[model samples]
Target: MLEALGLSTVNESVYRAMLTHPALDVAGLAAHLDLDPAQVHAALDVLADLALVRLDDTDGTARAVRPQTGLAALLAKVEADIAVRQQQIEAVRAAIADIAVTHEQHEVVLRLEGIDAVRDRLAELARTATTECLSFSPGGAQPADTLHAEAPLNAAALDRGVRIRNVYQDSFRNDPATLAHARRMATLGSESRTVPTLPMRLIIVDRSIALTPIDPREPRLGALELRSPGLVAGLLALFDQVWQQGSPFGEVPGARAGELTPQERALLQLFADGHTDESAARQLGISARSVQRLMNALTERLQASSRFQAGVEASRRGWI
Candidate 1:
């Protein structure tokens, strides 16, 4: 391998022979190395360029430089070249990182089709998350199949010391099985809270990636996976706000001492806060017709003829 240092076999052989036989002329060096005279001359020319040999102007003879000086200098040059290449590689890597950040923040949102795809993505996110996994599990009691599927994933994240915080609707408190499951998860180092309602089902991991349903009304339609930092940050803030307002998932209260159900109170507040029937139904994860039917029943229960009277009666009863 002196080839790597720009020396051919002929050049290296001539140089080594010349070093050992300083008194040998070109013709004698050729015989020593078993090379033709022209080949020896060509090797001498290359060796001189590599600083492996020097020309004596007085006698026009070529002499070999000491290996320690000549080889060391060539090695130093190789090292310098490597150092430059490393710097170039590092610069390219930095540029790629910047572009990747931009792409993740501005352009990446993947649509996951089918229940299996959604579960697969959730599994991946849970596996990789290192800091936090926050979720809003809306609607009423979770089905047995859902609890079964989610248990292992939640346990894995907790075992890895990743904080898992979940918010469920207050209606879940009325379901014994769901409440028990929530308590069990809490015992395993997960935090669970219940609100009157949730805007949608959402899961955010490490505040860097989020997944939500393509249609809030139909989770069966699958999910939309988001990596955009701005969108994820907004969803993260929403989770924090709702989580702060929720009651811990323990010792389920009886719809506020049997007067108004948690859902009724939330619906009243929604209406008073200027939400339309459709919007209120969306927040409650029900249909608009359901909101209207519920209101009609409320009016009849309060002995009121209209929504205005219902509102007034509800306020008088401290139900709003």
Candidate 2:
């Protein structure tokens, strides 16, 4: 153990013996250590140089050896050094916490307004993800900019081995854009599914972060980004719950082209005719809630948002 303090083997042994026999003549020290007289003297000389031991001349013939009292002070200093190092470590941890807070603000998390902002955010999400992208778009609440514009980013993400799992509404079965988008995603090895209308839109990237809109009527008008793992996980749970009930993309139940429902045709035509939710609901003799519900189901099925987008998607798929 004394060797750890940079003591030579002989010096360490001599010092240990000196501690036990605080004062001893060279002959007695050599005999007790089982070392030669010359070697015991040599070890004492080295220990003296290290301030661990010293000569004593209590008797007239100068035949005594003793340990220095300063060893106690050295041990005390070691304890003080450990305490100082522990305090320094705690200070570093506090500084890191401050830096993390500053970094969160510097990263600029905020609401993005309008179609342009929505488009940009989606592109940003696609570019930033490392492992996978999860999208739970209920009833096709996704904007037009997202529907047509994300193809390139999706393709790029696919090339980089990023998996994309998108859940849509069952009404998307008749949407041309939904079909085309699903086809493109499939070609890139991304997975898509359709379910009955879900109430909210959820987008998650890399399992570390997520974004969700506050209101379905104006999704771009307000949204929140969450970095907290617990919150993101909660949102993911809601998404998975809905996803479990969804059908795989491009899976139509019936055998033929006329297998589409009248509600699907009406929703498609009304959307193509440029009717807003209030206007469409008025023409259909239904409440706006019913229209919103239909919109949700349609977008999920068609993977669309507004009726106008659904119309364009329908034209592309020859469903019109």
Candidate 3:
């Protein structure tokens, strides 16, 4: 009964002992239960704090202990606490059930607040996925413990012959734990890749469902889950476009471009000739707006942060 009430084994024993005997000191109580005196005193202290027992003055000799005046009342309080917690759990479960039941009408996007909720939803998606799985995950997010919770779902999907393709940022390539995960996924026939960088987190399943972050920094508030085939197809098209230009799995994405933009060519030429953005703007007979536009486009296109790095990449691709 004490265990059912969430009491530890030692706590259960101590509480039971307190109920049976009254006004006994720690040593006397320990002798009765064949437990160490110190252990008995610690248990009594804990029980006292819990309001399950009280210290009784034994004529200035020893501080004996006894069950609280209203022992039954304490039990009722514990019962009430358990009941309230159970109700809360049931309410959350009901909410999730409602979300699923209402899915036929809408995409059922959720704005969850906590990391645990995000992890749980991701795990659910991975588990429920029937066919292909695509993930575009960036760095600095996702907890270390996330892999353990998601591993079973991933393995089960692989068992069912799911074609899983996961893309990580280049930074993840050197992470020992991530590498181990990639190897394990590969062993299960899932293809994993590391790109130079990804703008945000993305997950698409079977070309039927897609999820992406609206604001990568505030993932919970910014997440968008699409279930419509049209929206899914659009997201998949975007994924394919990036994947076609991205480097292969386990390969370093160092200065490689499977395709190049005309703006990128001009940007690289001007940058290589030691021209500033203003100079490039003048040389191209375009305004600074056009130059800045080209720079920003290159950033998105190559997933590069600065002009120098973009130039290096363009040169490596023989675009210069």
TM-score of each candidate structure, all chains considered together: 0.56, 0.46, 0.47
Tens-digit lDDT string for candidate 1 (22-53): 99987899888888987886676466546777
> Runs in model 1 with CA error above 4 Å?
1-107, 251-262, 270-307, 315-320
Instruction: Report lDDT (CA) for all predictions.
Output: 0.81, 0.66, 0.65
Question: In order, what is each prediction's RMSD in angstroms?
Answer: 33.3, 31.3, 25.2
Q: For residues 1-320, write the lDDT of model 3, one tens digit per residue.
A: 56553355776686776667655556677888889876765565345444565433454222323444445565787789889999999997996676566565574554545656666777788778888989887662345686777677888999988889887655565567877787787888888765544657788977887777746666655455667576578788878876776656666555434665443565566666546678666444456776788677875666654443455455566777
Sort the candidates on TM-score, descending order.
Answer: 1, 3, 2
lDDT of 2 by residue, 161-226 (tens): 998999876555545676677787898898987754555777888887777774666676756666
Top model number, lDDT: 1
Query: Which is better, 2 or 3, measured by TM-score?
Result: 3
Better of 1 and 2 by lDDT: 1
* TM-score of model 2 vs. true structure: 0.46
> What lDDT score goes with residue 188 in model 2?
84
